[model samples]
Target: MRYIHTIKPLGNRRLLAGSCMLILLPLFFLCFTQTARAGKDPNILFNGCQVLFQGEKPYIDQNNCTQVPADFAADYLGAVISQDTSQKTISITKGDTGIILWTEEKKALVNGREVSPDSGAVNRNGTVMVPLRLVCETLGSGVEWVAETKTIRVTLDNGYILPESTCLSIIAPPPGNPDKIGLSILLFLDRDLDKQYDDIHFIMTGIFDTIQADEIVKHIGQKKTPKDNLPYRKWVRDDRAVTAGSEPGDSSISIIIWETGG
Candidate 1:
């Protein structure tokens, strides 16, 4: 950013300098526009891990809506995205939900239904910037905009977004329906709250890198794998049974705990 100017012949050089400054003025404005267009890069945490954006980073627009890279956001949201440069169109689909939008257009298609919003995806220096909320909400994903920190947190339905080094557990029949026992409810638990349960049957989820199965094993006293090679490992402590596992392809882990004795 440091500039060096060499002194030359006094009279004609002064006039030449003025002419050069005029030419560089437009170039300076272009640089400023590029930087300001993206606004600021608020940290985006997808599934408890900060997403590293390549080329153009995610930023907040003037309207306070988040704009993100098309491919990156599609992958994180578990949606398949197809782009047509010639048409300036983007199509994102997850399960039965479908979303289609064009660059620089506020009109978007959700499940073949047309709706116009404030602003849609736009092309930024060859990178297609899509509105994070518009697409995520249509696909049934969680989008949290933290105004204080200016950060965005996203969670997809396929997996749970968990806190670092901690698991969020929730007992089955969740509070009101305590009488509905022995019910197997698969929950993608993402929060922690005080709950009362006379009989324990809880499901938990957390990040693997920040917290592993070993951390939960201690709370359940000791674990033992049956010599007969049972389908699942045994975890025992204070008449309680706990089992924790993670998918080989996923970064999150799931734990199920239940009371072994009444």
Candidate 2:
């Protein structure tokens, strides 16, 4: 036995908290569809924590750059933000990675690597607004914009994704599932739930449409764990069992997750 216990995620995988197992097909990971907000002011969630701005709320420009105050950006990124008032530059530093932006330029120097994303830092009124999506992703955090309520949800590497209730707010919540933290994003696209659970094994069923599955994963910024193994594919995070699976030649995604306790 070579003990092939792990299959690398095609990209950054945002598996929620706890250990889970999946018996899955060979998934093809494609360019993840980016979330966008239309013409609406967006509320922000940072690592499951709601961000409170002093006076200005988050604004998505026509260029689709989610801009926030420099101070708030510093707080959200846990970085030190400094300004060059004379030269009109803002330097945001986290660990060894440094990013420098200017109020008049869309170009930025990320650790001496010059790059630009959509738009750049802007001085609106007396406050310097920073391009949040660019900065957050630069710092290695996953960003998802919920167009329904015009919300920005962030998943930091040091933090888990949105909590159960918040996640349910983004996805369809079932009528009667025992609110498991990880299961909040599991299960199906849309269905009524009448589940029975007493001990070890738990099961539920959903009409699995591959496109819908991809859409669900995209909506929440999660990629399905892929493996060459046809029927048995496993992608679990930490240390508890919660999984989804389906049978061969079947169009159903069955939910099968368990834990030690009842």
Candidate 3:
């Protein structure tokens, strides 16, 4: 089984229903961490999708909905979109071949018993498979696929990670230099909470004692926010050793100090 198809731009149900009434709507959890081998290559992470395969069967293409034998040779490493419409159609055919292939308006069960997707089938490489804990519990999110060293963990609910000692080491005032003593540079992080303002990096360093001895590194990269809010930029150094750079993983920095001349 191998699959890799890319398509972007499909999430704007009135801006996610007005940003789900001003945020705080995240409750989907799935944690899977196992690996050994012999069970075959299996490693998947959801809601931040990471599905690596072997003897594969993980379908989802209810007539172009996407994710089925699309030149399968997989490695998506990214995906997050819990409820954008919920038409429902999860699959993993073969050996414990789980099936919730509901198309007539959605409704398929497993532990509740109601199987009839051609019943009991297992065929790796020749297609026909299932299991990855039944397509992450039928796409609700919470599936761990580990086959003796193969790891797959799908945990979603607006997943987040903004802990670099809670970054924030700012010191602005450089657009025109009021006293030429405005140092410190920048380092910030607000990570998608839309408040109107955005700045990710710009620092060079002159050692304001390592900009007051560290504290500027953040994360929380994908929750999708764009109505206006994600601001945190305060870096203005006119020489003293400041050379910062970001946008390559490990981001979530916040440092804004604008209140001088007292």
Candidate 4:
């Protein structure tokens, strides 16, 4: 036997419309949330291509500036970063350039002088995030911001090149390791020698710019056997090293000499 049943119709159209609205509202909200997140892409480009960070990826802060991990500048940009939680400050050193930033402060200390930047350093997720453009530029890198694609193009300015007979020297604390933490100078002779240069006596003088490396040497040369000058010792001797080089392997006979600096 076959049975036929009559379909029941809604008496109140408003109730049926209300039920539909409840279901559709949630779906609309989900779509809107997903689209908002998809539109926000923070990408950092080295030169013109994307460079991946080992652990943390750089993000765009509220100021719409790229903020990268502290280690990224240290490892890739050859910058030395130090943090003092008590002071809420972050210090970065590269070559003869040094900058100190306070969290949420718009001003930065460029080589001990205060200057305001577009964006300041911020603390996020226990990691200090620095303004990418200001820090990278201070580290001798050129940065271009593409607003249409939300990209930060960083072209690391090939470091200063030394004269043919000159040596690229670095004097500071050891980086990437902590066991050795005294004063040391690594001198890279621009020209190769059959053997190491022995008894290389040189006086130390500090300069504000890497381009002044040769000038500093000339200035010190004029000094007739100047007293042991360690101008940077008064500053924090932490894992901060000064360097001046465009690229590695361009020089021969790289010698690292350790000094007790007693």
Candidate 5:
């Protein structure tokens, strides 16, 4: 996969350490409405995750810019949207930031400053669709298009995205090892956990919502191997403490180990 990292001074972006294994299990539960095909169809991703559109799916307009339903920003980014039918204008507000756009206009007012969107706002099928990049940028988020997958990853403050690590390696014992059986997967990222909090909490949000650090520890502790005829212990064990801290640095790697017997 071709991945690009874009960083800007977005008011001190902070990194937090956590496991995203929860994201893998819940993929079965999500409902995919459709896929992005050519320019007629488009899929919207929120915070590097696919969004489940309720009504009209997103589409690319004549301007070659992706447009989404008016309420999409409100639902995903917590932005409040309001429209004036008589004036053909729309307004959005999040925290101290305010954005104003006109129906079929190419310029938007960001916090009282006029800015041109990659594409103007247009009303389609009674739904006001605006440029995807415009909405995200106005809301303090970054949008990246992955042409290989036809997917867009919109991250807040350029936060970490899925396939979390750029480099991954797995090591396992050869099959039929009489003395021991073990496996280890190392996931590495290009950045470090900001400040390295001592009591760092692991909150996995994505496929699943934010999970508490304590819950993860308990889940690992309760894991039991299935009963079988094999002489090895039922459960696998690893040296990792459910709660661990990162070293002081900009790069980080997490090694997760699973073992059956020794």
Candidate 6:
């Protein structure tokens, strides 16, 4: 007579381990693929953009102007020319190309070769068109164009995230005394209400080192109150004191500290 035999299938721990391996194996392969493809795409960041003309005026007239600096003159481009006193949106044109703008420092792969852009400019029509090959190489954002979509997909470097477009405003400390406690204030327009710090405005207040006093005063102006009675050094409207930039729909203002001493 044949005897009936019973066999145990598998333990939960063994099954779990096998399942984990199954999930991890594909993830490993995916990571390898991404690394290999990383060589093809480069990541790029926008530091700053501006327009320059023969007269040396960066942005002239509210409307008509000559020569704009942006990321790309065609396709994808962002302009630095301040559209208004608030300096919210840099003039962006669609279908323009070859603009110049500054970018963060890093090596990127473009068309299989590495490249960098000390600065670049954009064109009219607001299309940020750059030397596709160069910008892609420097930013390490895989540069690929799809005719069907008429779009450029820039795959950023792994672990890289776009910075929140925010303004940096700094208020310097009082004159003389570098070691004194200072105040650095940041103000941003809460658009999303998420409180993630979308836009930034900085105001720094404290004692200033004697050597830096003159330069600080020159840029931001003298304190509204007396040197001894000054309530945090006041900010003046000087070319150097205030810097403006653009955001999607909002504006930004920055106040930088020049010195510590009065």
Give the winner by TM-score.
1
Model 4 ranges off by over 4 Å:
1-39, 159-262
Q: On residues 1-262, what C-alpha lDDT tens digit does candidate 4 reach at each position?
A: 1111111221211100001111111111111111123325466655333555544456655455566766656644655667777999888775456777899877677776566666688786676777777776666566665556655566545432212122223223323223333223333342222111221222222213333334434332332222323222122122323322122333322222222232
**lDDT by residue for model 3 over 169-244, one digit each (tens)?**
2222222233433333223233332321222222212223344323232232331323323343334333422223
Give Cα-based local distance difference scores for all models.
0.48, 0.47, 0.29, 0.45, 0.46, 0.25
What is candidate 3's local distance difference test score? 0.29
Superposition TM-score, candidate 1 onto the true structure: 0.50
Clashes of each: 0, 5, 56, 1, 1, 63
Weakest 10 consecutive residues of candidate 3 by summed lDDT:
15-24
Write candidate 5's Cα lDDT for 1-262 as tens digits: 3222221111221112222111112221122223444366654555333565655667776566777776666645545677777988777665556667788877776666666565667787777776677776656565676676777666554222223222222223322234332323222343222211111222222112234443433333232222211121122224212222223341333333333333
lDDT of 1 by residue, 177-260 (tens): 223221121112222212211112222323222133444433322222212122235455554455654433333234454445
Which RMSD does model 2 reach against the true structure?
Answer: 17.3
Candidate 6 Cα errors over 4 Å, as ranges: 1-130, 139-190, 193-262
Model 6 residue 7 CA deviation in Å? 71
Which is better, 3 or 4, measured by lDDT?
4
Instruction: Report lDDT (Cα) of residue 98, candidate 1.
Output: 63
How does model 6 fare in lDDT? 0.25
RMSD of each: 19.7, 17.3, 19.2, 24.0, 18.1, 24.8
Worst 10 residues of 5 by lDDT: 7-16
| lDDT ranking from best candidate downward | 1, 2, 5, 4, 3, 6
lDDT by residue for model 2 (1-262), tens: 1111111111221211211222212111111124554344677775444665665556776676777777654444445667778999888765555677889677777777666556778887777788876676665556776666666776654223233222121221211224432232232223212211100111111222344334333322222222211243333323434344544443324333333133
